[model samples]
Target: MLVSTLLERLQSDPGRPRLTWYGDDGERIELSGAVLANWVAKTTNLLVEEYDVQPGSMVGVNLPVHWRTVTWALASWRVGATVVLLDGAPEDPAAGNLDVVVTDSPDSWTGSSADLVVVSLPMLARRYDGDLPPGAVDAAAAVMTYADQIIYAPEPDPGRPALTGSGVAGAAGNAVVGHDELVPEAGPEEGVRTLVDGRGRAADVLRQLLRVWAAAGSVVLTGPATAAALEADTARRDRLVATEKIERIA
Candidate 1:
């Protein structure tokens, strides 16, 4: 349902900057709806063509809250694959049925049984600089090679699970969310321009972005760049709101 809305918006507002990021390393990247859509399409192709992620197949994602991770989640859903949130280290056995695991720190998953796709967090990354495992795919490089639009039709079951987040050790767990639970449309267009603090839980951040986009809104995701500086300084935070023309902070 969310994916359908996104496809519609991509055609209508291709130039609108739907996702903007402020990196901790003094960098800013903005992805218009069309651009974001292209990345998602490419990722979907990578999942289907390279890994054959069909409906009900699990795809583990263990990465920080960033624009790239957002793309991964959307793409995983596009192909009817269940997006499973893996807690960073791969040693945990909460969800072992994952067909592929997309992550930044590939070292942790040294001998992971599932296929690994190592990702570089930077927006401009063409390929991962670090060495990958024997069968691991360099997602930064591979994603670019895939087609920019969806090549196959995917009719996923609405009753099947879309996302699953299992707790690792001491952390709280989350319940399975089916496609039916993903509401087709937001109540009304609130025109909310959200300022996202990147320190929140990964699943929560992804859900917030999905809701904001579903409402036909935009997002300004803040990395450690503004989160740390604005944490203690109200004045700085106010200036950011003014500078970014933010309507809400998520």
Candidate 2:
């Protein structure tokens, strides 16, 4: 299904479970499918009516790994906006590459190269409570945090894939052990690069994909500019897969 279809279904369905969010601090936030749709719709209104984020516009997201990022990214895509991940204020102001930058910290700055209409990430975060900013979507990305600095870790060897049984998957399958799941204590090889721990957030990824696909919604993975959204999205998906509702593809 397409992204819009998913949104429409959720909007029409008034009662389907949508999210199973696991915070980095080990917190859990559950959102019904209907609730998620309402939040996204409000977010979309904020982007369109408030932020003026029209179709084809580029919006930057700078949030940590959290559920808020997911809704905001989905909202941006819902309005046909390109979600740009920002590492930091661009080094130059003349770059003029972005239309908006979403940040959580009020003091966050992107730089002069990429001019942005800066806004608060908290604004989007509050959407869960149904609070949205007035002039949002007027910029490219929200003022969120993805943290700029990349740490290189050695990749793990690929292991055999196996089927997990009942009681084997708990708290989103954090316990299902696998050979490839191990990570090296040392850094990566001279030319090798890894996106994250490399234990395969497949469980989480699969869940998110399934939900989104079921919703048929479009999502932007902006790990380059505002990796916070990307990282958060990845983590959330991992949790969903581990929740036991996501079955491995045969």
Candidate 3:
């Protein structure tokens, strides 16, 4: 299935912490399997019901490595939209054909013809306080109104591109990976605990998330490469390891 089993597998243990995000801005957001699934479901419903996104639609994500970006990616995948990692500037063919775009900075994409969703960076923000351009959606404000449970869409074409615009060098210059290659079959529920590097490219982060969750694992995602790099700050690393009970770093 093009839709990942990670979210579905999370249902078995709703209370278990599935994703833990430590923001560089001193925000710590933790979501259990149930909570993460709910966010993804709500965002998924919002995309299809409000924006008409479905299978084969290209959804652009031009955001930094954070918890909200993760939710957006999972939601787009659930709705069968191909996720194009814009990272603010996309020099790819797929970027020009996006059906919808989700971005932290709406001003950059305000002129684009594609449907725009301006997401707030803060997790507690129920609305993006900043002014959005005409036709741009206030995702944070509207998301709360969406259904907690997802109204599942039809299965997407597994052979179609699942992710693109990755930094990996290629003939097309946009690193693309198919759904059949990206989404894995459900693996054992070992509930492995690992630390995910949030400093990497969006594609790399997404790939690591898929792998960790496939084993019914939990992840403590470190913030972007900040003043205290994960490698240099042995104290922070040791603290995170001890506090989060990290079994390994991915």
Candidate 4:
């Protein structure tokens, strides 16, 4: 189904629980479907009107495993643009051909193209600079792979605390720490998504996790797995998801 379908559903159900980001430090960031819809609208405007990213154009995303990535990708699809995911490096031919590049860090894109426009995640979140496209509606959201926005929730709490959050500096939205949370020492930006502590088939486990989260949809893994070795698991998972279906969430 189109991405707009999800947005509409979420909008209609403003309180519907859509995205939840949990840190290892037992903290959590919850994004309601309503909020996600608005962000997607803003991101859509930035790509089309401000950057002139035309429909059918390829767009690159290089953000941490956070809601911003998900919203940006959805916005691109709403405009009929193809999302070129570059989780790692070497930059795929598809990504290189992108008309515009939206990333957390503009420096991440080493491509040579006058059309590539990098939209920093921090900029988008902190500032309201992008222009909105005329009559841009999230009609057709882009399909995303599970790892498109890799996420690892803090270890599940034996007893989930009230859906409350603590106030932290530079924290995206409201994130609260609970006794049962994983309390990740790193934030989403640091790229310390999950605790990939042990070795042995970590790649396989990550792949499985991606397939499950992506709703058994198509996915690709770029290169350069940071501290998480996400790239390794992404590669294996892409293949596995292609052959079979796995259902999961982060």
Off by over 4 Å in 3: 89-94, 168-174, 185-189
Q: Which stretches of candidate 2 lie over 4 Å from their true place?
A: 92-96, 110-212, 215-250
Against the true structure, what is each candidate's TM-score? 0.91, 0.49, 0.91, 0.47
Runs in model 1 with CA error above 4 Å?
Answer: 166-174
Residue lDDT tens for model 4, 132-168: 2332222123212122221221222223321121111
**Model 2, TM vs. native:** 0.49
Worst 10 residues of 2 by lDDT: 147-156
Q: Whole-model lDDT, candidate 1?
A: 0.80
> Is 2 or 4 the stronger prediction by TM-score?
2
Reference-based lDDT, residue 67, model 1: 84
Q: Write candidate 1's Cα lDDT for 154-199 as tens digits.
A: 7566777788775311113336777655434674756688898887
RMSD of each: 2.9, 16.4, 2.6, 17.9
Ranking of all candidate structures by their lDDT, best first: 3, 1, 2, 4
Weakest ten-residue segment in model 3 by summed lDDT: 166-175
